[model samples]
Target: MLGIFVLAPILIGTIAYIIRDTWAKPLLFLFQFSYVAFAFSQFLSVKANGPIIWNTGGYTDGLALSLFADSLSIFMVLMTSFIYLAFLIFAVNADYFHSKFYFMFLVLEGLIMGLFLSSDLFNIFVFSEVSTVVVSILIMLNKEKQAIYDGMIYFFVNVIGSSFLLFGAGMIYRTFGLLDIRAVSAAMPMLEEPQAMILPYAMMIVTVSNKTAVMPLFSWLPKAHGTPSAPPVISAVLSGLYIKSGVYLFIRFNQMFAPVIDMQSFFFWVGFFTSVMGVIMALGQRDIKLFLAYSTVSQVGLIVVGLSMGSNVAYWGAVYHIFNHALFKSTLFLTSGLIEKEYKTRNIHEIRGLFRRMPWVGAATAFAVLGITGAPFFNGSISKYMIANGTKDAGITLLLNIINLGTILSYVKYSAMLFGKSREEQPGKPERIAAATAFVLGVISLFTGLFGEFLTEFFFGIELQVDTAEYIKKSLVYVFMLVAGVAFYKGLLKRDRILERIGTTELTFNGIITVMTGYFITILVFLSSVL
Candidate 1:
């Protein structure tokens, strides 16, 4: 299954490369639609009782090439295909459309499919590296000096993360003498020593954090995400599906190491800190793109907290939010891209009264902002309710309720920049491709939220109650958050304070400190067990 899906895009690109003249564009479009059709078929076939496993090639004792399609994998597959379709449309209409660009895009599409479907640990490492390298090529396509700098930072941070991933995979293989994820998970209890499990678990956390841009490891993400030249879809995929690859591994391994590790406390604290830090940084941003980039970091922290709860509801929350965040966040970024292209500036202060100029884009941005902030009749509300319920059940102390408030506060800042009250009109035209994608996804978000229960059950194979009264209660909390955010912004406006002024030098210092801290902490634990 994985090989077929992964190979499809590569095959198209290779064929396109060969033809290069008459048929390349047609072929690219054909392959894009074909993959989406195939993905939807796979989704329909998957049952919640168990996953569908396909092992086309034999495995060496220490390496396996296999694929599995479960509810989770199906959702990711669908997302990759849908997002790729939008990117393809953008490519067709882009001012500069090169064959090389299409090739890179197709290769990334295939690699992501492989990453999501692979059932082997070593295979995850292989495909993840492929995705990273190919996406780096897209970043360089920005044709700006800052793009290269951002790409370099992206390369440096990801290499550090990849090292951790490989080390952890090696540790697991060394301990169990197997490379397949299902086998390692099943055999985890057979290992007699607790330290063997703890070592790999901690390494896995570092690796996952590096990819997902969790606090302390997220220095590269803002730079990479804010790079001016990359397309909005690329930014969306980078922040959305690609980052979740690490989170997927964490979820898989968390189940295996549940007995040896206390993931709840670790995720809660890291998530709390990241959430606060991300929003604070976003509030101080002059560039709206950077604001959205940091917002991705903060929202990812919320997803992590939900995943760490380790309950069925929390699991549902994490998974569902992954979908919600992808659609809403992408809509926001694409809308921002359109705004920047029209006004010829990324500064929010310079672009005031945009709502009157581009009413359609403004409306789209409003929908996305409300959706991500967990407003009622939106997808965010559904998943957030589940997380709140699970948090109470998990007894996670400190900031459970506070985190919910922060979600609303952060979006309040977002709204001010995106849809401020001043309605000044400017004469201009909108980018057709960008606006189309934004509007389509915005409508999809509203549909998802209105039928939120149906979508949840369809994906997870479990039906949950729709608590109307509790939902109303949650709305009140959001109202409070909005009020607080307005107050904070008013204060900042009056005082002219710096909110996101972590100098590049400061970020570099923090990155160094974080990487070293991760290394020494792992070693200390390993030595403690040995001594």
Candidate 2:
């Protein structure tokens, strides 16, 4: 059954590609929906019966290939399914939905599912590499000159990352005589020389950090996510779902190596710096897609910080934020694509009067902006509050607030497109299905916050106690930040020369690789010192 979840999509997508008919898309969509339903049922069964472990060779010993689905993996599977479903629905109206595009997209989706479900370290590496190739093809589908360059950069960087991952997996296999993550984790405590594991840990984590778009290794993200040639749905999936695969691996490997090394503090600080730098870069972007892309970098940083905080509440908050970010950010990207399609421009400064011209898209965009900026009664606010509540230090709490302020300020510039006089008119009516999908996502973003406590408990079996007084206090803080963000944008950011330079500047392919190398070495040194 676990194999079915991973293999069914690949098979169906391949068949669809072979058919190459006009009806291939609808047929593919039906197959995908059926697979998602089956996967959800499996998820529920796992939830009721506990983890399901499948040994493909039917061997009970360590030599067999293993796939395991626990609460966490199944949850991710469900999230991936829903996001892909939304993307598919939007793609129904897209012009680029050819047989080859769906083929690569489904292949990528299946590989990601395999990544989440596979318990073997080698399997994870294999899945990661295959997904990287498929995603690069999708990135370069339009064959634009800049897109080709961005796609090559993305491809080579990930190829390097995957090679590191494979090396790390080989080390673990040699050390433990087993490649299964569960088996290795069980054996971790038995090792007499835990220090021997440090090099493997560093290699694997540095690679995962690059995947998660951590600072210094994040240069590929904005390029890939904001590539004008890629479809909006592709951008949404890349930002919302693809990146979380890296974060999932980070969490998995960190826990797997907990007996040998604990570097939560290092990751927590890295996440803080990433969040700060991400938003700073976001504040300088004039292109709407690039702005959202950098915001994703910042949000991923916040998620990392929450997970590394050593508090269960904060950890769960980070998990919830992952889901919330997918909802809001995907909506923002999809809606931005619609706006760009209508106006034939990507510049935020040139586009105007979305509210008057396309009210539904405008409303959805507004909700997404509010959700992302941590507005009171929005989904981001709840997750941010939970993460903040987990912090013991005043200084860290203040830093969290500053990150929130930065988020608000960046969106203040973004929200400009929602209002003002129109510069051009759209030619045709918008696609109803796409508009409806975005609006539904926007509604989910709002309702997720309104019912945060119940949903958190339902999803993760973690009870959250809401403090009304604290909520009120945080609301006031949000209001203050809202006012302050507006002032900062109007008075300072609008006139800042340095920010413009930082935003407009991008690293070359070699520069990105250099940063990744530097980050890997830094991690090695830091871990050596701490351990």
Candidate 3:
């Protein structure tokens, strides 16, 4: 069953391509729905039973190619399968919803599922490399000049990053003579010196960090996700879901190294700095896609912080945040596409009167904004509240607030487009399928938040009791931050010369590579010093 989850999509996608778009349409609709059902059933099975492990080629557990579905990974598989269905629904009426596009899209889904489920290290590398190729193709699917350039940068940079994973996986294999992650993790404790693992850890993390879009290694994210020519669904998937794969792997790798290595403190601080940098960059973006892209960087940073906080509650909080981020961020990106079409522009300032011109789009976008800003009774608030409860340190709590404030401030600029007199008339109700899909996602964002406590338990099997008084207190803080955000945006941030200049600042490809190299070395040095 676990192997089928990974392979069926790839097979079906190929069949869809061979049969062409005319037949492919219904085929995909049926397959995608079934895929979601299958994934959900698997999720229930994993919840009822413990972990499920399948070793392919009929080999032994640690010796054969393996697929391991634990509570964590099963949830990821379910999320990807379900969300891809939403993306498919969003794309059904789109111009690019042809045979070729669906082929790549479903193929990408299969590879991502592979990444989530595979227990073999080499298989993970293969999946990562293939997915990078698939994503580059999607980025340049239109073949526009700028799209081509962006895709080329994405392809080459990610390939280089993937190389680090290959090296790391090889080292692990060489060390333990086992390719399965579970096997190596069990073997790690037997090593006399953990120092031998440092080089491998550094190599693999550089790749994961790059994929997660952390500081110094995040320049490529905007180029790929914020590309002007890519389809909105592409951007949504890349930002909302694909990025979380890295976070998933980071958790896995950390667990694998838990016996011999622990560097949560260092990464916690790195995540903090990355969050701040992402905020500064996001605040400067004029393009909605770029702004959302940068905000993803910030949110991912915050998730990393939660993960690295060395608390069980915070780890689960970060995990929950991944799901919430996937919901709200995907909605934002999908709605942005509608906003762009209606306004005939992507400029944040040029677009106006979202609520007035297109109520559904505007409302949906607003819901997402509320969630992303951690407004009370939203999914983001629930996840963030969990993260906050993970620590008792006043300074850490204050820093988390600072990050949330930055989020609010950037979205203040985003929300400006939601209201004001419209310069152009709205289209025939914002393309019903697109509008409806995004609106539902936005609704889900709110719905999840309203029942976040129950949903987290249902999904993660962890009952994290929330403190009502503290949550009420936090809600008050959110209200204050929202007001402050608006005041700051009105008082000083609008059309500021410094901010405009900052928005325009971008690193070249060479510069990104250099930063990545430096990041890799820093991880190596930091781990060496700490361990």
Candidate 4:
């Protein structure tokens, strides 16, 4: 089941390449939908926590490709399957892209599935690198020079990271004489591990951090996602579902090294700073896609904190939030794309009277905004509350509070752009394409709200007990935060002083100061603890 689920996209992609026509699109869509069905079937039949691994060549123990289906992998597979479906459907309305769009996208989809399912260390690295490359190729579908530039940067960064990962794998193999994840875990305790052996770990961290767009390493993300030719929903998936995979690997690797290092303080503060940094960047963007792209960086910081906090509840909450982010963010980006299709703009400043002409898109944007901002009765609200509760238990209340403040401020900026009065009134009929897309997304968002608890239980292997009282309390907190953030945005963002700081391009000296200061502070604290 796991191998089929992972390999289906590759097979489909190959077929699509051999037979490119109108039929190819529907075929790709079918394969995506089939994967979704396979996931649900597996969920019904498989045990909650047990892993099923399929190894080729008659199940040889030493050297064969293996795919593992666990709850975590299944959850990601299911999420991507649905998202790809939406991406393809939404893409149908666009102009002719390269034939390789279908091929590369499906192959990338397969690679992600394989990455999620792989139980082998080297294989995980292999599949991850492949997926990264495929994504770069997909970006080239736009044929923009910026796409090529960003793609090259992405390629270099991932290659460097992969080298570190390979070195790390080599070190682990030398120490334990094993390459499989399960075997390595079982053998890790007895290995003669040097503290400096973590250089590979550090490199791998840098690699995944860049991929996931953590604050300092995230300069490429806005450029890549803000590209005009890429589908907005695809951008959303890049931000929402795909980035979480790196975080997932980080968490998985962290567990292996738990005995040697404690990352609680480090991750808490890293997440805190990254969260604040991301939302601040988000606030200054005039383009809607760029704003959402920065918002993803911020939300990712929160997910990282949740994973690093390491409480069972926190871990599961983070995973739940991954699912929610994928759905709502993609929906929001798709809505933005639909608006751009109709109005031919993503500039928030020029995107006035959208509610008058494209009310459904506006409304869908409203729901998605509400969802990501953690409003009550939506999927984002539940996971965020869970994350907050989990963080409190993990002694990260202060960091979480700062993130909350930043998130509220970011969303307030977004909403103000939408609801603000238009400078010019233009009356026009609603676009069916925009309306249809928005309606679908709005329904999905509402569905997510109603069955939020069910999703958590199904995806995370935890029972969600609905607490009406807690929900009410959290609702009030959200309301208050929203109000406070709006006030701050109006008072501070409207001011020339703060706006100048936000809009100004920092120079080489400033960039160096930031990186050195942040990196030094991080290492100093770690060294202090060790000494």
Candidate 5:
């Protein structure tokens, strides 16, 4: 059953690719629906029984290929299935839909699912490399203008990251003579020299950081996610779900190496700065997609902060945020795509009267903005509050608030498009499926906020008793931040030349790789010093 979750998609995708007929797409869609149903069943099974483990060739030793599905892995699989299903629906009505596109898309989906489920280190490396190739190809699929250059940069940089992962895996294999994660965990505490694992841990984590788009290594994210030529659905998936794979691995590896390394504080500070820089960069973006792209960097940073806090409450909050971010961010990106189509431009300044012309898209966009900015009744506010509750450090709490303020400011700039008069009425009716998808996601975003505690308990089996009075107090703080964000945007960001320059500046491929190298070296040195 566990193997079916990973292999079925690949098998169907390969068949679709070979067929290359119009019917192939419909067949692929059926397979996607089947997979979602299968994932839901797996989730229930995991809840009722224990974790599911399957070893190929009936070999139980570390050398055999294995798939393990626990609550976390199954939950992630379910989330990916939902998002991919939405993407598939959107693609059905999109100009980019074709047999070839569906084939690659399905292949990528299988690889991602496998990455989440694999129990062996080597299997993870293999899945990551294949997924990297598929994503680069998808990124360059349209081949418009700099698409080739963008794809090459994404490919080369991630290949370098993959090399680091391979080296780290080798180190682990040499140290323990085993490759299974469970086996490594069992062997870790009995090792004579715990400090010997630091180098491998650091190497692997830095590579994961690049995938998660933390700090300097993040240069590739905006380029990949906000590429003008790529399909908007691709951007939505990449920002909303794909990068979470890196985060998931970050958590997994930290658990595996816990006996030898304690780097929670290191990631916490890095995430803090990444959040700060992400929002600052977002403030300068004129393109709506690019603005959302940088905002994702900021959100991922916040998620990292939550996960690194070493508190179970914060860990769950981080997990919930990953889910919430996927919902709201996907809504934003899908709606942005609709707006771009209707307005004939991606510039925030040039686009206006969204409400007057395309009310559905405007309303969906507004809901997403409110959710992301952590408005009192929105989903983001709940997760943000939970994450805040996990920390006792004043400085860390203050930094969280600052990040929240920056978030509000960026979205305030974004919401301007919802107002003002339209230059012309949009021609033709909007795509019904796209509009329906966005609206449904928007509604879920609101409902998740309204019933956050219940949903959290339902999904994660953690009871969260809400303190209404305390929440009301936090709501007041949110209002203050909203007002401050408005003032800051109007008074400073509106006329700031330096910020404009910073936002508009683009880095070349070489410059990006240089930053990644510096990031790797800095993490290595910091870990060496601390250890």
Candidate 6:
């Protein structure tokens, strides 16, 4: 059953490509629905029973190749299934929704599920490497010069980054004499010294941090995610669902080393600096896709902070936020495609009056904006509230508020397109299916928030009480931040030369590889000193 999650998509995708006819799309949709239903059943089963583990070759759990599905990993698989379907529908009428695209796209889905469910360290590295190649292919699907350059850079940098993971996995296997993460974790208590794992931890954290796009090493994100020639759904998946794999690995890897290590404080700062840098760079983007890409860097920072908080509430909040980000970011990216085509431009300042020209798309964009900005009753607010409530430290709360403020500020620029009069005389006819798919997902962004508590319970199987008074207080703070963000954006961020240069500045491929090596060494040095 676990392998089915990884195998079914690849098989179905191949069948879709081979059909490559009118029947192909119908078959794809039918298979997609079945996948989602099966995923949901697995989620429910994980809740009702316990984890489902499979060992290939009928070997013992610790020694054999392993597939394990618990509450968290299965839920991720289910989330990917749902969004991959939505993305499929979103691209149904697209020019690039041909057989080859579906082949690679569905295969990417399976690879991501493999990342979520695989318990073997070596298998995780294999999945990551393959997914990197698949993503590069998707990026280059446009076959334009820019896409090729960006895709190549993406391929090389990620391949280099993944080597660190391979090394880390080998080191761990050598030290613990186990390849299974569960097996390694269970053996941790017997380890003679914490220092034995520091090198492995540092090596692994480098790959995860690079994949997660934290500061100094985040230069590849806008280039890869905001590639001018890639399909919008590619951007959506990369930003929305695919990047979460790094985050998922971060959680799992930490657990593997948990018995002998604790580095929450170090990572919390890493997340904070990343958050600030993300917002600062985002504020100056003229390209819509680039702006959104930088925003993702910032949002990932927040998720990292929550995960690093060492509080269960904050950790789950980060996980739930991952799901929320998928909804809103996917909606934004999908709608950006529609808006870009209708306006025939990608410049944020050049595009005007989306609300007047494309009412449905504008509405959907507005809903996502509300959700991402953490407006009351939107899904982002609930998770953010939980992250804030994770600690009583006033300074931490203040820093969180500041990050939220920066998020609000960056989005203020994005939301501007939703208002004003169109420069075009007449609007183009809306793509009905695309518009409907994006709109439906946008609406879910709101509904998910309205039922945030219940969804958290069901998705995570944990009942968490939200203090009404505290929530109200946080809502008030959000309102204030909204107002402040608007004022700050209009007053200073609108024309800041420093920010403009920062946003445009990015590392070349060689530079990115250099930074990756430097980051790995820094992590090793830091761990050596502390551990």
Candidate 4 local lDDT, residue 131: 84
lDDT of 4 at 141: 63
Better of 1 and 5 by TM-score: 5
lDDT by residue (399-444, candidate 1, tens digit) is 6566656666666656665554443455456877667778888877
Q: 140-173, model 4: which lDDT tens digit per residue?
A: 6677886776666556556655676777787777
lDDT of 2 by residue, 297-337 (tens): 99999999999999999999999999999999999999998
Model 6 bad stretches (over 4 Å) = none
State the C-alpha lDDT per candidate. 0.75, 0.89, 0.91, 0.72, 0.87, 0.91
Give me the runs in candidate 4 sitting further than 4 Å from their true place. Answer: 59-63, 192-196, 391-395, 420-435, 497-531
Clash pairs for candidate 4: none
**Tens-digit lDDT track of model 5 for 110-152:** 8989989998998999999999999999989998767877888
* Predicted candidate 6, C-alpha RMSD: 1.0
lDDT of 3 by residue, 115-161 (tens): 99999889999999999999999999999999999999999999999
**Pairing residues by index, what is the TM-score of model 3?**
0.99
Residue 513 error, candidate 5, Å: 2.4
TM-score, cand. 2 vs. native:
0.98
Tens digit per residue, CA lDDT, model 6, 102-155: 999999999999999999989999999999999999999989999999999989
Root-mean-square deviation of candidate 5? 1.5
Q: Candidate 1 at residue 461, lDDT?
A: 71
TM-scores for candidates 1 onward, in order: 0.92, 0.98, 0.99, 0.91, 0.97, 0.99
Against the true structure, what is every candidate's RMSD?
2.8, 1.4, 1.0, 3.1, 1.5, 1.0
